[model samples]
Target: MRPQLLALLARAPAYGYELKQGLEQTFGPAYPQPNIGQIYVTLGRLEKGGLIRGQEVAQDGRPDKKVYEITEEGIQELAEWFAAPTEGPRVRDEFFMKLVLAPGTELADQLTLINNQRRHCLTMMRGLNRLAAEEQGNRVSQLLIEGAVLHLQADLDWLERCQEELT
Candidate 1:
């Protein structure tokens, strides 16, 4: 959230409400709606950390508003965030742990667990397909949905491998 706000500020100076609106407009339905309170809190933290400087601008008839601009430090941090490669999903995930540990315990069988997970993944893919169709004109939303569908496909494939090897 901090980095996102910094990136937005790097583009132009904006107040808290404007930042919230910008995120929604930019990401569309692909990104979750940010909490306004959370945004203000993050802005305060950034100001204290010297990543941003806020200026109080008096309005004509309303209360004063604070507009925030990115500091040089904020720009550097945003650059680092852009350059860093994100880590892939973990291999030892919840399903894998359950599959490996279930046999020794009183939990359900490994094959049953794999089948259940596969069903869930397919259901999710179906829902994503519907969302993708609805968001066809929105490239960002479409891309995000496509990525989720692909990940679900990979999980289904892995489940197949588990079924063959374990059962």
Candidate 2:
């Protein structure tokens, strides 16, 4: 959230409400929208950290609003973030733990666990595919949905591998 807001501020100075609206417009409904309170809290933290500076502007018949602009340090940080490669998805250890420890616990059947997980993945993939279809006009949302579907497909494949190994 910090980096995202910093990047937005790098574009132009904006009040918290403007930034919130901008994010929703840019990402559409695919991205979770942060409440105004969350935005202000983040802005306060950024101002304290010196990544952004806020100036209170007076308006007739309205409350004064603090507009935020990114500092030089924020620009450098944003540049670094753009240059850095994102880390790959991590495998959840909870599932692995369940698979390995099921025999010791009352959950003695690992096959059932795998089957249930596979079913869940398939159901999720179907929903994501439907969402992707609905978002076909929006490339960003479509891409996000496609990525989710691919990950779920990989999970399903991994479940099959786990079943083979365990059996």
Poorest 10 consecutive residues by lDDT, candidate 1: 25-34
- lDDT, candidate 1, 76-139, per-residue tens: 9999999999997896699999898899787689988998999999998998888777777878
- My TM-score estimates for the predictions, one after another, are 0.89, 0.88
- What's the CA error at residue 99 for candidate 2, in Å? 1.8
Model 2: which ten-residue window has the lowest total lDDT? 23-32
**Model 2: lDDT to the true structure:** 0.88
Give residue 43's error in model 1 in angstroms.
1.8
Total backbone clashes of model 1? Answer: 0
TM-score of 2: 0.88
Q: How well is each residue in 38-129 modelled by candidate 2, as lDDT tens digits?
A: 99999999999999999999999999989999999989888999999998767666887889889868856899999988899999888887
**Pairs with steric clashes in candidate 2:** none
